[model samples]
Target: MSRRHVPAVLALVAGALVAVPAQAAHAATVQVPCSVPDLVKAINTANGTPRADTIRLARGCTYKLRAPDPVNPGNGLPVITSEITIDGRGATIERDGQGGEVPRFRIIYVDKTGVLKLIRTTIRGGYATDCPAFPDAVGASCGGGISNNGKMRITHSKFTGNTSASPVFAQGGGIDSPGSAKSTISDTEVSGNHVVYTGQEPESGAAGGGISNDGPLTITDSKLSGNTATVTPDTRSTAFGAGIISFFGTTIKNTVISGNRAFAEKGTARAAVSNGIPADSGRLTVIGGAVRDNVSDAPGGVAQGGGIANNALMTVKGVKISGNRAVAKDGIARGGGVRVGPSGTLDLKESRITGNTVEAPGGTAQGAGIDNPDGGVLRAERNEILRNTATAENGTAQGGGLYHAAGLPASGTSTLKRNTITDNRAADGGGIFRASGGLTLNGDVVRENRPNNCAPTGTVPGCTG
Candidate 1:
């Protein structure tokens, strides 16, 4: 335990340090040059390395791929299999294939072992062709921009001009995160994305024009607009969420979903945002966002759930759902603002649903503002549902502000408190309509509609014209 032993210990420590690989000591920072091949090589090197790496891309460069990557077939870059963060200095990574026909392959694919953090990048012109069965390869031929099965955090980015097309079904025109992925997207713009599916079932058909999150995901301070989800299913099913669809527990905070369209051969299901599935329960919490100017069109079926659709346990707080439309060319039009499905339960508070509309060219137009017609429940408090309209070109209109078909076929409850339902227009039940269900209204004002308020006056107690 003296100076002689100190020299021996120091020698042993130096030998051990020499045995450790340089990459294992700490994460490396890789700088990619201003060229396509260089970017690909950098990604490949970082992915092949044995540690987390930060790849700093060339500033203001456009690394466009000329062909498919050999490492990851049908992709623009190597498959991500390691923890890597691409610090893009206002750059773009896209595919520039033959004739620029929206390159058939996607831009990025993150494997299950990967953890990708992409920042300050723009991804565009990614076109994903379809597959007959999804949830198979995260539906390999989907998610035009990025197909993520691992952890991903994307911030300060843009995804535009991406597309998903299929003869049967497709999803995630811009991005798809599935299979137990941990994803967070913030300060992003996801617009001009499109999905088209011509299948027989809308439930598995065109969905999530902007982003699809079947995993646990959190999106904040993002804008999703001008996304289209079109489904031509032969039969009846739900094509949900033209702007965004989540089938798992999701949180969307301070995000704006506007100008998205959902069109179906049968029905649009929902235009702006759709949450959850019917067989299994899900949860979605939307706080302080705007869902505006979204459209749900169905020439073959009904126009339902124009602004927001929920089949999960959803909670909407301090949000605005206005200027949305539900158009039906041959069937009925309902739920111009928000629709709660048979298995859904909505807890909407401190929100506004105004200036929404429903139009049926040959059928009835009902529930111009909000509709809870099935077994689902609606507990809306401290909200406003006003200035909505229901118009029928050849039939009748009803339920201008709110419609609660409580016990027609299924039994549910509608408990409304501290809400305003006024200045809506319809042929009947201009403010509120209750075909049947256990309805409890307290601290609400229903007035100044086109017709008298609350049809079948005796059906609702303590309310009369």
Candidate 2:
């Protein structure tokens, strides 16, 4: 029992403590035959625990929520507050109908403090209707299938037949993330989702039938198709972005946004993929993507940007924008391919804007290929603007190839360099229309357009028949 012996013993104990590893965070794995209640219990347990958990569903099984609490915030499952991962193994999670109507609730809701990851799953038949009791205060009735207010990552997943309906505003029929939530989706398919608004005014309409992101969202290798946003008996309301509406910045790569519809029965409908609303500060960057076969129809009102509506900043490289239509039954129709609104900016390179049409049966049609209206700036290089049409059966149709509207309080400018503009049809300015803004045409071949190549308005150098 010497002092040196005591020091040696203490050293040995410290070395033994270091050799023993600290207890690792326990991860629970929940297996198949997962009923609604069982899934809810697993999620709750994971949220209450201190570590991440995994929930594995049986292959091809469909876990349906038969009866859900209509007024609760999260109906089928409790709000997720911790890190959890759900591996579906090609299974499906759906909300069943009570009587004849789908349950008015979302399938999964992630709270602000939660983190959820979904892989290889199918989410279908979720309906979020009359949600957030105080819709005006919340500003969202969204995410019929999955709503994330936190961080979410989805890979190899499919979202189908999800609907977000509200009397006021409905957004993100498939997935909704607002405010500082971050989400990354890869190799996913968002299809057959609908965002419908029955409100009387256009300001209280629906948007983002497939996905609504007010936060930062990145989507890669994804397909958004057969989605719709509709405003019924529209009264100046805008039903836009059938594929996606990013109120904040969004990055999309290797994506296909096709066969989407944004239709307003009476009011203004705009864009298949909208970067941001006029009041929001956002940007859209698409690299190697295709936006085609989309329609924006405001039968009794105005229709704009059948393919894309950029109210903020947009940069598109190596993208194909084709076969889009903007049709108005009574009002104006503009930008069948792309629309750059006031204070908006667009930088397009190596893109194809072709076969787009803007039809205004009773009003004016402008910019069938590209529209830079009122203080918007567009710089397109090495792009093909061809086979576009702006037809006004009763009114004027201008700028079949490209339209640069008169700058009102501010001046809009467009620079088309190294572009081939041809075979377009319009009442005036068949090739290019420059009203008040400056349209700079450098190394652009404007030819073979019906009626004339360029309108004699603004100074467009290098424009000839």
lDDT of 1 by residue, 170-253 (tens): 678898876465589999999999877755533445678999776678999999999998876545645567899876678999
Which digits, one per residue and each the tens of the lDDT, describe model 2 over residues 290-329? 9999999988788889999887788999999999999997
Error of 1 at 223 (Å): 0.2
Instruction: Work out the TM-score per prediction.
Output: 0.90, 0.90
The 0-to-1 C-alpha lDDT of every candidate, in the order given, reads 0.78, 0.80
RMSD of 1: 11.9
- Evaluated against the true structure, the overall lDDT of model 2 is 0.80
Shift in Å, residue 50, candidate 1: 2.4
In model 1, which regions exceed 4 Å deviation?
1-25, 97-103, 130-140, 199-204, 233-238, 267-269, 278-282, 407-409
Backbone clash count, each prediction separately: 3, 2
**lDDT score, candidate 1:** 0.78
The list of candidate 2 runs beyond 4 A from truth reads: 1-26, 69-74, 130-140, 179-181, 277-282
